[model samples]
Each structure stands twice: as structure tokens, then as C-alpha cells.
Target: MKSRISRLASVMFIGAVLAGCSTFGNTFYTASYTSVSDAGYVIPAIPTEKIPPQYRRQIVNYATNEAPGTIIVDTKSKFLYFIMPGGKAMRYGIGVGREGFEWSGTARIAMKREWPTWTPPAAMIRRQPELAKYRNGMSPGLKNPLGARALYLFNKGGDTGYRIHGTPEWWSIGKAMSSGCIRMMNHDIIDLYERAEQGAKVIVQQ
Candidate 1:
């Protein structure tokens, strides 16, 4: 009995040490995705200038029930909540679906990609045929629709094509401006990318 207890304690101590060392290492950080002059980002400096000054109040409190791994999107409230443990949350401003394309449901993150290629959906192409020209693939650069990262949502085996991606149109941050995809400022999207995992749960509330 004494030998067994000592062996068990030794294993438990090793596991605890490994977990503590993991916490000491940084898991993720923002990449310097651009050079000095080529980048076109200007959103963070003037939040009021990019988005409506009225939404400032909504931006501050940023409450949520989402745990450290859950994503809760309140489309009506125009806020995306990344739930943190201990009753705290990291909230972000989002632009939801446009007039005729709003949707709500639960989905799992099927995959994640950094600086993913942009491929506009056929419906978007139908609405604006001008987009047909880029059907092949848009390389990762400033003008690409999926700016710094993309979190693809899935229900069952189907692709919703409703990505949470970065956008050049930061002025529409708090508006119903996209055909269906949720848009976030590049920096904010980058921030979100760091926290999201491949199989994270997402709840989109209408």
C-alpha cells in the first residue's frame, strides 16, 4: 500500500508540472501581416469615425455567457461574445446579415485558416456579377475579403459559407451590411482568431 501511494503521487506531480509549464508558454499572438507602407488599415485609431459614435456604449460593457471556448453572437445587439471563465467575457462589434439574408442557429467550427483565400458564393456572384471574375481564388493580400483569418461554421456536413472574417469596410462595423457573412474590423478579427479553436461551439442568436 505504501509503495502504491508513492507511485500515484509521483505521477500526479508530473502531470501538474506539465500543465503549469504549458500555461507559461504563449499559445497565440498577432502576426505582423503586412509591411509598413502597403497596409491600408485605419480602423482602430478612430472607432467613432469608422463606426457610428452612438454604439460606443454597447462596445464597453460587453457581457456574455460564453465560456472560454464558446462563441455567442447576438445579431440583434450587434455584439459577438467570446465567453471567458469566471463570469467574464471578451466582446467584439460585428456587422450581421443584410436585409434579406439574416439567419440564426447553432454550429460548430469546422475549420480555421489564417489569411484564407476568398471565394465569393454563387448567390453573391448573382447579386453582383462583377465578382464572377475572381471565382478561381483571391490570394491573401490587403484587398482579399477574408483579411487575416476565417472561422468556417458548419451544421452537420454542409458548409454555411457564413464566415466570421475581416473586412476592408470597417465603416459598416455595427450595421447590417453583408449578404450573410459576419464582418469584423481586421484587428478585431485577428483578435478573435487567436481565441477560436477548430471545434469550438458557435451560437448565433437572432
Candidate 2:
């Protein structure tokens, strides 16, 4: 009778531990990618399971001399780290510029817009003539390339013409396939937009 009672207690403890781990995993993904409504638009829930674990948004220990609130983009590794107090960072998977389109520099967030209009640069229109139809500007919506928010970057020269912005193509996260802009998953961008402030420093590294 004593042996049976000890075994039963051990089994119950193991079951409880397993249950806690399962609950944590579910809560982590569900809370991060839940659907949200903003500015009269319904932002759909992302299927985060399709994304690699490393690309998903998470807090991590980071070592950097840069002050808290700075944004650092690691193009090669395809990660964006927003520095936080206490030597930690909120990291998000990012989509970076491809090959020749890549750029690196220090800039500051000069402006921010929710559901921003996208106007193709004259050079971009020349390369992709179909975009000429939007020479004026494209209305903001789900199909819009800029997604739900935009943080415009600028330097002393003014208007670097690159943005750290949201993308509807969540699958594009953790890849190199953009036109010089840094792209974040729409859900991730919304979170970052709330945390990052105008005039925050941005560092882009190869």
C-alpha cells in the first residue's frame, strides 16, 4: 500500500509539470499573434506556427553600448533589436533589403504614421513601371506594402527615404527580400510602434 501511494504522487507531479508547460506554449503564441482592430481596419491573426521560433517576437538578454530605446537592425541575421533598460531587448524577426538594394547607416525616426500612404520613389517607378499608377500615392489598406504603421528614418541630410515599417507578408520575416526598407510582421510592428518614439536612434548593420 505504501509503494502504490508513492508512485501515484510521483505521477501526479509529472502530470502537473507537463500541463504547465503546455499552457505556457499556448499562451505565448496566442497572445502575440491575436487579431486586432485598429483605425477601422481588422488586422488578421497571424499563423505564427508557420514561422521559425527564432523569428518570432521575444525578449532577450542583449549587450550593447547604445542607449535604451535605440533600434538596431542586423540585416545578415535578419533580426531587429529594440534596446530596453536593464541590458535586455525586445527582438523581432525582420525582412531586409536584397543584394544591391541593401544599405547601412545611422538615422533617427523623424516621423511616424498609422496606415501610411505609400508613394513609390521616381526611381522605383522607373524600375517597376507598373507602380507609376501610384505616382501620387497609394491609399492605406491591407494590400498596401507599408502595412499598418511606418517609422520614417532621417539623418542630418534629411529623409533617408528608408522606413522601418510593417508588412502584410508575415512570411517575409526572417528573409532578405525588400526594396531597402526594413519590414516587420504587422503584429510585431504594432507592438514596436507603441514602444518606439519619434527621434529614436536607428542603427542598420550588415
Which is the leading candidate under TM-score?
A: 2
In candidate 1, what are the lDDT values of residues 94-160, reduced to their tens digit? 8989999899998988988877899888877898999998788778776777776789999886888
Measured against the true structure, the TM-scores of the candidates, in listed sequence, are: 0.72, 0.85
Q: What CA RMSD would you report for each candidate?
A: 9.6, 7.8
Q: What TM-score does candidate 2 reach?
A: 0.85
What tens-digit string does per-residue lDDT give for candidate 2 at 1-206? 99999999999998875553323353332126768899999998888679888888877789999999999999999999999999989888999998899999899999999999999999999999999999999999998999999999999999999999999999998888999999998888888999999999999999
**How well does model 2 score by local distance difference test?**
0.90
Candidate 2 at 132: error in angstroms? 0.7
The 10-residue segment with the lowest total lDDT in model 2: 22-31
Candidate number with greatest lDDT: 2
